[model samples]
Target: MPRPLWTGAISFGLVTIPVKVVSATEDHSIHFRQVHLEDMGRVRTKKVCELDGQALSQDEIGKGYELSKEQTVPITDEELDQMPLPTAKAIEIVSFVDAESIDPIRISDSYYLATDGQVAAKPYTLLRKALERSDKVAIAKFAWHNRERLGLLRVREGAIVLHSMRWPDEIRSPESLAPRKVELDEGEIERAVQLTDTMALDTITGFRDAYRDALEKLLTAKSEGKELPEPAEGGEREQGQVLDLMAALNASVAAAKESRGEAGGGEATVHEMRPSKKATAQKTASRKKSTAQKTTAKKTAEVKKTTAGRKRTARKQSAS
Candidate 1:
C-alpha cells in the first residue's frame, strides 16, 4: 500500500469522514548533478549570513520577517503556533458546482482520497456517487503541511479525487500575462476551428507527448554511455487563431465529421503546410535514392574507363 501524504476528515455540517490523501500524480523525470566546470567535480552550495560574513549552523538559524527596508522581526515555532488561524485539520466541502464551469488554469496537483475505516466509508461513498451522478465537483478547503488550500473534489475511477486549486488571487489574469492581441477574419477563424476539430482527441490517450518522450530517450541514452548525435533543427512551425464566430463553428462541425472517417463528399483538405509533412518525407526519400543511383553510375563509368585504357596499353606494348 502507498503511504498517505496527509490524513484528514471530510466535514459537512455535522458529518466527518476520516480519509487519507495519497498523491495521484507521479513525475519520473531524470535529474542530473551540477559540477564545477574547472575540475569537473561535484559542486556544493553553502548558506552564509550576508551582513556579518558568518556561516551559521543549521540549528542556529531562526525564521524572520522583513517588515521594512531596515526593520526585521524574528519569531519562534511556539509563536508561529499561536498565530490566528482556523484549525488545519479538515477537508470542508462547501458546495458542489459543474466541473465544466471551473477554469482549467485553476487546477493544481491531484491526490486520491481513501476512507480511513468503517465510519468513513458511508460519507466517502455517498459524496463520490453524488458527484459522479450529478456531474458536479465539490469545491472544498483542506489544510496540508501547515497551509490551507482550496481544492476541487471529484469522482475518479471509484475513488474521490482531490485536486488542489489555485486561489483567484494566486492565478494571474490572462490578459496581463500576455498583452499582445490579434483579431482574426471570418475565413481564417473558420479554418482554424476546422483544424482543431480534425485534431481533437477524446480519451486523452489519443495524444502522445512526442517531444518529452524524445527528450527522455536522449537523456537515457546519454546516461547509458551512448551519446546521441545532435538532431537537425527544424525551423518554427505555423500557428493559428480565429476572428469569425459563425465560420469557426461551421468549420469545427465539418472537422468533427471528417475526423470520424467521413471526409466523403470532398477531397481531404490536404493541410496547407510549408513543405507539408508528406511532401517533406517524399522529398527526403527521393534525394537519398537519387544520391545512391549517382554514386553507383559513377563507379560503373570509372571501371569502364579503366578497362579501356588497360586494353590500349597492352596493344601499344605488343606493337613495340
Candidate 2:
C-alpha cells in the first residue's frame, strides 16, 4: 500500500476513530521541461534578496505576513510551530449534513481515510456504515500542511472518502453570468426535452478522451522516428445560425432520432424536414450566385486589361 500523508483521529462525540489519509487521485498530465532552443540546455532558477542584492540560502529564508504596502510581519519557524489550533491532531466532526445539501462547487481535492491500525478497524467500519445508512456526510475540520482545512467525510464503496472543501465565501455569486432573462415557449421547450432524451446516456462507461489518445500516438510516432500520421477528418459540425428556433429544435430532434436508429415517421417530423430542406437549398443557391459573381468580375477585369494593352501598343506605333 502507498504511504499515508497524514495520521489522525476522527473525533465524533465520545468516539474516536484513528485513521490515515492517503490521496485518492494520481497526476496523469504530460509534463515538459523548459529548454534553450539553441543548445537544448535546461533552465535553472535562483532566489535572490532584493534588499541585499544577494542570492540567499534556503536556511536564511523566513515566512512573512504582509501588513501593509510598507510593512510586513516576519514569522519564524519556532513561532509557527508553537501556534495553537484545536484541530491540529484530530479530525473533529463539526456537523452532519445531507449529502446533496453540500454544493459540489465547494469541493476541492479528495483523499481516502483508512484505519490507522487493527484497533481502529471496527470504529472505522461502524462510522462508514452509519454514514451510508443515513445518506449524510460529516463536515469536519483539521490542520494539515500548517493550515486548518474544512473537509467532508462520506462513505464511498464501503470506504471513507474525505473531500477538502472551500470556505463558504469562496464561491462567487452567479449574478454576473446573466445579462438578461429571455422567455421560453412551451412547444420549443418540449422539442428540446425530446432531443435531450434521445441523446442521454445511461452510464459514463463509454466516455473517451480522443485528444489524449491522439497525443500519445503522436509522441510514440515521434520517438520511433516514423512518419507522422495525418489527422482523421469528419469531426466538424454544421454551426448554422438559428433564424427559426422552433425549426432548429425540430431538426435537432429528427437528427438525434436518426442517430438512435429510430424511424422518422409521423406528420410532425415531415413538416420539420420541409423547412430545413428549403433553408439549406436557399443557402446553397446564395453561395452559387456569390461564386458566379466573383468569376464574372475576374473575367471582366481580364478583358479590360487586354483592351488597355492593345490601345497602349497602337498609341506607341502612332507616336513612332
Candidate 3:
C-alpha cells in the first residue's frame, strides 16, 4: 500500500473517525526525461537566486508571494500552521446531498479514506454504512497543503472515498461557449438518437488506450535495435468540406450496428418523417384539381370532333 498523503479525522455530528487519505487511482503512463542529445547525459534544472546568482538547495527554498515586480512576502510553514482554520485536521461534514446533484466537472482527484487504527474501525464502518443506506454523498471541508478545499465523501465498495472538488467560483461560465441558434429536422434528431443507441454500452471497462499501446511498442522496438513500426493507414476528412448531417448520422448508425455484429451490416435504418396533416390535405386537393382539368379537356376535344364530322356530312348531302 502507498503511504498516506494526509492523516485526519472525519467529524460527524458527535462522532470522530480517524482516517488516512491515500490516492484511489494509479498512473501507468510512460514519462520521458530531458537529456543531452549528443552526449546522452541527463539534463537537470537548478534553482538559483536572481540577485545573488547562486544556486540554492532544497532547504534554502521557501514559499513566498510576489507583491510586485520588486517586492515579495515570505511566508513560513510555522506561521501557516498557526493560522486559524476550523477544518485544519478534520474532514468536517457540512451537509448531505443526492449524489446526482454534484456536477461532475467540479470533482477532481479522488482518495480513499482508510481507518487509521483499530479504535477508528467502528465509527468508520458506521459512517460508511450510513452513506450507503442514505444513498447520498456528504459534502465536507478539509484543509490540506495550507489551503482549505471542498470535498465529497461517499461509500464505494464498502469503503469511504473522498473526492476533491473546486469551489463554486472556480468554475467558469459555459454560456459563451454555447453554439449559435440553429434549426434541426425531426428526422435528423431521430437518426442521431438511433446512432447513440447503437453505440451504447453497459460499461466502459472494455476500452483501452491505443496511443499508449503504440508508444510502448515504439519503446520496445528502440530498445531491441529494431526497425520502427510503420504508421497506420487512414485519412481524416478534408478541412472546409461541407458535410450532410443526415447522411453522416445514417452512416454512423450503420457503422455502430456493424461493429456490434447486429443484422443489416451495410444498410442504415432510416426513420422517415411523417408529413403534417395540412401538407397531406394540400396534396390530395392538388391531385383532385388536376384530374378534373384533364377530364374537362378530354370532353371538349370529343365535342369539337363530332361537330366537324356533322358539318362534313351536311356538305355531302347538299352536293348530292
Tens-digit lDDT string for candidate 3 (81-152): 888998999999999999999999999999999999999999999999899889999999999988999999
Model 1, 89-136: lDDT tens digits are 689989989988999999999999989989899988887778888999
* Model 2 global lDDT (CA atoms, 0 to 1): 0.86
Tens-digit lDDT track of model 2 for 25-66? 987666678889999899877899988889988998989999
lDDT of each: 0.79, 0.86, 0.90
Instruction: Return the top candidate by lDDT.
Output: 3
lDDT of 1: 0.79
Q: What is the descending TM-score order?
A: 3, 2, 1
Best model number under TM-score:
3
| Candidate 2 C-alpha RMSD relative to the actual structure | 7.4
Per-residue error at 215 for model 3, in Å? Answer: 0.7
TM-scores for candidates 1 onward, in order = 0.67, 0.78, 0.81
